[model samples]
Target: MNQLNVSEFIATSDFRRFHFLLLIIGFFCVIFDGYDTAVFGAILPSMMKEWHLTAVEAGALGSYSLFGMLFGAFTFGVLADRYGRKRMVAVTVILFSLFTALGGIAPGPKVFGFFRFMAGLGLGGILPNAIALLTDYSPKKTRTTITAIVFCGYCLGGMLSPFIGILAIGNYGWRIVLWVGALPLIFLPLAYRYMPESSFILLREGRREELLAVLARINPARKIDAEVRLYEEHDVSTRVPLAGLFGEGRALSTVMFTAAIFFHLILGYGLINWLPKLMLEAGFSMNSSLMFLIVLQCGAIVGTVVMGYAGDHYSLKRILVGMYLLGSVTMVLFALNRNATLAYVLIAVAGVPVVGAMNLVQVYISQFYPAFVRSTAMGFSSSVGRVGGMLGPLLAGWLVDMSFSIHSMFFAFAIPGVLSAISISAVQHRYSTDRSRKGQAEVGMRLAGEVEK
Candidate 1:
């Protein structure tokens, strides 16, 4: 049988209609993730007032969902590696949507926190798998771009949440605002019908016939058949996917990347959760605060696209490092600036790296590991970042509780951004050094072989 590496087949294939369809399905899933997560921020004022929650209590309430996300990202990631991406994707969507609708009925803080936690589990599961599936389908020439495009769904959903809040939360109530999160159910059937199983998983299972058929559909001209045996770049014999992440001279890089994610997320989720409230405290009206969120998301969309394009052409690590540094500067500026027009402009700049960098990390981690462990690595990195995600809101709220100056609160948050930049730069330097050494070894071997001949 002719050996056909499914990863190679996919990485070399031309972009097709099927590819577009895959992007759409993953896109919508990300949108729901964005909307569900951001809605909490949008309606926080209303929810806090109704429940009479202290700032610390409100921060704790937000952390409950982030905690859920931490568990969900890790759990579902491992499950996706074991069970298959399609099933986990479907399961997570249903799980989060169900819990989101249930959130509307929550009578008090504990119950509300419970429902948010449940929904957070689903939120945690969706992104990594979505990125993994999309990565498997995409060509290398444009993989980063496609991943960013799909992630833009998240930015769109986040951008829309405030508008929904303006229209629905103001008139109806915060409960009604959360009820809309259930709307993803309408798209669930479409996702199930259209989403394909990960081709790499099929290859690993030695499902030749199925793999061939999938390959053919991805590119009809390839004429894949029974004679073809699917191959993969990663050794399938590496039975433990999680161990593989820490093996292969990858331990240090993995730890550094995870640390980078942790710091960046603290900055990212902290801003996302509190930006509206921070603006309100800064003397902007409620409506203006929501508008600032919209602008931030809008900037996020542009930043995601810009960074994706840059990543494809330049050093991905350098791009991230620069973005993180810029993010730190922008956060400091965002807090100090009181002029409405200037603050909007500063927050928009902040959004480019603060929010957009998270999307970059998704694409970055996907490229870092092989298909066998892609989801696991993504899940682990994101789950680690969830530590920051969980702490970010709580820290911000605590500062508010303690009456820390707003500008200084942001200055403290900026420290993580600086640390994130340093962490990513270290990874980049290691990667570059390794590549150089490998290149030198290859040249040495080639020269010796020539002399021997």
Candidate 2:
């Protein structure tokens, strides 16, 4: 492939526009991901009644999608590391958008489940790659905040789903909602045309010219010093085996982070998957239940923005743990409430902390690993968490079928939230110490090099 020309890349307006443009693209991609993921839940009752499906079968549809996400997160994550972040992101979006659109034409639950699985694959792949892409280009000081902003797109998309369901599904059908899920395809072409490959990838590949071009695009105002070429390390390999995450010094942190993710996703997905049904059981009308879900997601959007800012200024660990703990408490309150206003308030409060912590978890994971292994770490953690996500709905379905009160289900999910908060708190303490050591090591290396010179 021909290398990008640094001078030409810097001179164009496209270079100056690239960062914000990529952020916009990332935002839209995540929005679609949220829409497609939540569609099944939003219209599950309609689908069940129309298809004469059992609760177990309807629950399988959700699990199948998450199963696909498990595979997609690992497979595409490795692909992003070996190939490139931009390419994989483009491929994932196209795959998801196409499959999501295909879901509109399913003849039965099985077929719908299959298409949703495929869409989940695309959904799974997009998130890690998108996080990696944003982190690669973002300024170090603002990395976590930028990631939180991108994650807010998911909440924003979720908040819009109930409105879409009430307006479109009521008028047309659930099929219209499925078809609208494909609207994300509009962003695929834009991603292909404008999204640049990550500078870190180019640096690892020893493509100095390409790295310079990407840097120029990211910051056109800064003049590149002639002697300050991209650091070329020939020993760097992008191919990181999944097993490497647990090898030697990396094992404990890896396992802890994975466990934290598992609990976080379990609570997050469980609540999201069952919130509407829970509301209905709590005596809300169908419209009221759906409206409450929308309010919950709106709280999530606001919480993500606030927590993102907080995560940057304070410790990510403190913010994440606090949120999860608050979520657990609010969930209990939500389950006990019967008053309409109180129920809505509790549910919205529960949603606020849950999603904000989820956003921080993504940001923290991305920061924990180095660039070459970053996507792989993201994939592994996400894949493990997806297992919990898959189980959440299935377990809830089983509990509901057993005639357990909705309050019991909420209490069960709350246990995972408490555990996850503890895990994150521990990991945070470790990461703080490790970061300090690494900083000292870097200073020592610099000092030794200067003395030798």
Candidate 3:
């Protein structure tokens, strides 16, 4: 009898408590990641006032964290693939949480930037591994949806940050908000206790007993007879996973998606990092600016769920293309609006297509690669996007320094979405062609097998 593949088992198994527990735990991990990342934007106004910094300096500060994230995504992603995913998750959570708190206590802008950069490293490290763990466990039928649910933590954290800033900044100051980010450290023990090692990794390392033990816990009702063999479908003996992304006819898809992710992140980080300050400049009060941020996140929550559902049922590539096109329109409208209520509405709408689509990029990328290279692919792609993430806020600041009008700045941001839409369209064509070829090859194999029989 052929050995049972772990992925096959995952696809065939009924949804169980173990599956739901994994999603909940993954949600908690991403929540703090979102919170710490967004809090900087929320508290930037206060930082500017306290330090008397210019827009360029503030933008550069935002880039500092993203630069760390770029490094972390590539470095930690490789490490997780080599060593394991479970311990990396726990360590990153602790590292980011501690440094985020230290950021609150830093006496100067440079020191604060250093702490933020360190926290970025942790924040960057969590995502690809978290998604990899979730992918290893989820059924293929629901992989995209499960990822979206896990990512909702990001929107939730982003939503909560502005509110926290509003309440904490008013009462205790911006530092208090940073100090609150340290709360994730309290959950570190839970991460260690609950998170399981990847069965795929276990099997690859010849740890059969350990792999069987995890699989059994995953479905306690099922008994594993001695006759049962366990395995995966592909050979991953090529020690370097990153090379596989360039092989297996994946190079073009990888490059196209990387470019798409890069541009999408530019729009995402740019808007989130600078929105409050831009609103303040537009004459909104501190409380109101934070409220705009809240509204934006609320829209993001809605958009994320909607996109997740759509991706599951419809063509993900087409849906993403439509979203980017819509985002272009929304950004322009957001720039032109002046009425307070209407501006709120426009910003909220902007969040749906812009922030919403940005969330979907990871889900789309995850689906593009095979299991062995999934984490590495996610890490490298996200690392590329982090380059955009770093450039975005810095560009916003530089544009501000150059005294560019807000309208022109937003228009510049919108241009990337158009390019992203075109690139994804090309990707869709390539993917369709690949699938057709796969179908033909499978048909040929089936015929040959029948003849032999």
Candidate 4:
């Protein structure tokens, strides 16, 4: 009886072993997402030469994937809320894995583009679910830190893709690179066997037994408190209405949040997708261009970890605004300075703040919404960003095709960075006002109930 009690206590604790395991799983999934997204950019130059494609054509192929991601993100957001996070994650992973492998076997650019777009759909669905799942398991105090650390997987994958592309393309071909990219499929079985559904979701669904089961698996050494029971009561309204995010006082804030994601992603994805080509056009060799891209991503990884800490300790909004300003200034400097060494240094500096800002935005979005609508909010915001991401590469490709100087293209990208700074600043201001209003309203309600009693 004592041993059973110990086992139950261990399983029900808030800081359970299963929670960390889930984070690891999420980290791996996101790493694959980063690798798949970055690999195309790394191999684009070679693919163009082999297929006799123009810059515009390649950009279209890139946009095709983003378009697919938009659909996937939106669809999975709704499905995850209506169905379950685990189910949606499983479906999306399988979808992306199969399509990513198929991309290697494409007979032409058209076929390849279709496969990439399909893969994008899976990519889109996986991330929001991962965020929701991780958030569910994470302790409140360490939530932001854990989320940011997990996201570093994205940066690591992006940084490693160029090296992988360089070696694989040289030894075999771009097709082989795509084939190897599908290796993430190996994780699906693990997810199926080991990944627990969100405890919150279980409580929401009124499956108390299942919730207890998961809690036991996660935290095998704690007493279940009355607070845990309270969670079930509050989670009774788990079926979130899709329009609820825009209803009540949430409409304007939701729109602004969506716009903020749009502009940030435009700057982030535009810079990432075009960095290698931009460096090459600036007279760097292919190998050097790839190296510079790697440096940029390495900076991003460091920035993400640092900013994650800052977000928890300081003002997230202030950090986000400052990072944008830093990115804009660095963009202008990179455009002006043609020296390869100096350019690499500037890009690295710029990348630190840019990726840091992006990571914080994801963390902020996850925290802003209640658990009931968290996945929906993440999905919608990410989908809107995907729209911007879809357009960014295409727009840059158009400029490149029009014979615009690489310096001019960098300046164009910098405009969005500046705009993002302004947009996010406005969002921060509005958020403060909204918070104040909510606080006052709550106080008023409490006073009214006291009077009635």
Candidate 5:
């Protein structure tokens, strides 16, 4: 008779069509997530003009959604851990999609801000939940690469926003670009149907039949006879999900991750929300400024693929540290750049570390905690990071208002990249749950891999 450990089975399973479906779905969902989040930056210039706003007010306005994300990430993480990932994903998609469209129709800044804040709640919740979903299903060996591929949808969305904005804003106005956000609501049903439930949920509920069915689908070549018995590899912890994030020797690392996310977002949002304004201030036309965003995002997409593959093959931590270092250098170079061709290249490199590196950080935190608390860990870290993200645009606005030269401004932004690298380096990797599980999963893989839904 053969005995089965469900977690080990899924972790060790071979790649299948079902796994590919999840990857494709995860990729597209995050693409929409990227689009909705980046839309605000796209419209920021127009909002400044129509609202008769100063740089400070516009930055403050951008922070409203960040506030919503802070609350949403924590709240959604707890709920996803308790209820399930798929349900929470649906709730957030609808929440952001509807309110984002509403923002387009808002009569004034107050109304627009309110709508954005509401949408921010959804935006805040989306990535953590989506990543958690993929983390649960992807094979442990290729998890970093798989998750990174799905995560790139975010940069792809960032790229999409400016391209669309340049075209539509000329005739249809910024509002038309936002109205496109509502498109995701149409795919909600298909996602709801196809998205797999967390195997943890099924195993916890003791749904042996359904769990077995999913395992069969995960590895169609595998067979289970009547002689086999199945067991969950890791039982659900009775302890509160948030509490677990700080337990099991994770407190220092959790704080370190939170801080790293904080600095990353500051650099990311500062560049994302303010780069166009910076370019425009340097005498570039609005379209040219927007084109810079597209180039930056393209660099992010390339960086994400390269770094993900490198992290998988080399040391994940080392790659992250190097990326942060590289990103900071790019910013300094951008400050000294005189040639247009070189400036474009510099902006692209900045995106690699500023935006692309965050995806790897997500991979790290997701793998750090136990399955029971993964979402909570990601959410709490992201929510706290949202505080920094909230401040990024506002800080940039203040920086722009000051009497400093553009050289000084780029130098200031580079500081956070260095801080982010330091934070990651300080994390205590000895306590990571993923490290412990890797050898165990590898052993189980040699036993012909476990399969799950």
Candidate 6:
């Protein structure tokens, strides 16, 4: 009687064509996610002028979508765990893509804000599912690296925002740029057709035929007897109640993780949402200000790659602690430097730590909790972190309305860096759900024996 444990098989699976395909799927999803988030920032200047909206009003509009995201994370993040990751991901992509297109054609600010809020729900839902999906299948040795590479597409999409704003708005106005949000609908069919459903969900439901199909695709060369049985190694811990997130010596780290994410996002959303407007106020042309966002995202791409590699090699916790502190310095320099040329360079440098911190932390959270609760953990943190995401823009608008100096604008941005550093510094690493290297190595060995039965 041949038997296979799904966890052991996935942990030991080689990185092959199948894994690379999955990487492409994850990368494209993140790119659209980035594009959707950065779109508001890119269009804000144009939208403000055309709509004659005040900074405070514009900021409130921005928070509407983030508010929807807060709920989406709380709702879909948990639903994915129950309904199926692929299905929930598909549903989210549709919700955001179709509604954002509606937002583009809206005649008034109120309607646009309404549509965007609807899109935000889908936008917010994608991350937990994407992170959960990638982590479930990626080789343990390369998991962090792979996740970083995929999520960096967020910055890649951000890099395109300014260029799209320049071209689309110049030709067809802001609505054209927004209309582009629906392009993901075209990408959906291909993904739905190729992407495999989560094995854990399948196993829990006892979907034998589907599991067999996925197992064959995951390891095409490995022989599987027609009657091979599938099972999970029973662990008392895996069966624990969801409350285990706060129990089992994990309560402190949970709070710290939520706090770190909150502070990081305050810096992240505040910067992305307001950078162009702040630059315009600082006396640059609209085009020049938009270009700064490109530099920032390019810097983010560089940061994402570097941090992912570094975190894989060093302690992710320690690296994050240092990165937040460095972000404070970069943000301050970027804010005070009036020279457009120098500002571009400084802002780009700022994106590395600020944007990179966002990607790496999501990767960390996906790893921090066990698979049973992984999606819920990510959802809860994001749902809470989104409060910062929601308030960052609103607060920035208030600062602008108060007529704070550009330097003060970023100085507000910087204080959170220290707070974030303090928060992440407190997380206890001994409780991380990630398996140790030696244990993972043993899982790899066990695969060979199990396949021969």
Task: Point to the candidate with the largest lDDT.
Answer: 5
Candidate 4, 136-254: lDDT as tens digits:
66765567778888888888888777877767777788787677667777868876678877654565566666666676576556455423432421132545546756754666666
Q: Give the Å error, residue 7, model 6.
A: 1.6
Best-to-worst ranking by lDDT: 5, 6, 1, 3, 2, 4
Q: CA lDDT, every prediction? A: 0.82, 0.75, 0.80, 0.74, 0.84, 0.83
C-alpha-based local distance difference test score of model 3: 0.80
For candidate 5, lDDT tens digit of each residue in 160-277? 8888889999788889888888998998899889898777766665666877788888887989765566665544644578888887688999999999899989988878888877
Worst 10 residues of 5 by lDDT: 444-453
Which TM-score value belongs to model 4? 0.89
Q: lDDT score, residue 186, model 6?
A: 95
Off by over 4 Å in 1: 428-453
Candidate 6, residues 1-453: lDDT per residue as tens digits?
A: 777777668878888888899999989988888888888999999999999999999999999889889989868877877677899889888988888789788999999999989999998899889888988888777888899999899899887777799778877898888888899999899998988887777776667788778878788998778778776432212243246468657899888988988888888988899988998998988888898889889988888888898877888898888889999998778667767688878887888778988888888888877665677778888888899998899999999999999988887898888999999999997878764434545676332211221
- Tens-digit per-residue lDDT, 27-75, candidate 2: 9888888887777778876777789877677777778888899999989
Clashes per candidate (backbone, < 3 Å):
0, 0, 0, 12, 2, 0
Predicted structure with the largest TM-score when compared to the true one: 5
Give the poorly placed runs of model 3, Cα more than 4 Å off. 428-453
| Whole-model alpha-carbon lDDT for candidate 2 | 0.75
In candidate 3, what are the lDDT values of residues 96-163, reduced to their tens digit? 89999999999999999999899999988898888888877877677778888888888889888899
Error of 4 at 43 (Å): 1.2
Alpha-carbon TM-score of each model against the true structure: 0.93, 0.90, 0.93, 0.89, 0.95, 0.93
lDDT of 1 at 362: 81
Clashes of 6: 0
Instruction: Please give the distance, in angstroms, between residue 301's alpha carbon in candidate 2 and its true position after superposition.
Output: 1.1
Candidate 4, residue 93: lDDT: 82
Among all windows of 10 consecutive residues in model 3, the one with the lowest summed lDDT is 444-453
For all the candidates, what are their Cα RMSDs to the real structure?
4.8, 4.9, 3.9, 5.3, 3.1, 3.4
Deviation in Å, model 4, residue 162 alpha carbon: 1.0
| Predicted candidate 1 versus true structure: per-residue lDDT over 1-453, tens digit per residue | 355556667888888988999999999999989988888889888888899989899999999889989989988998888778999999899878889889899999899899999999999999989999899889878899999998999998898788888888777887887888898899899779878888766655656566566777789986755554455655554366789678666777788888998998788777788878887888888888988888988988999999998888887888888989999999888667767789888888888888898899788878877677888989998898899998889988999889887788888878999999888877734433223344544565321100000
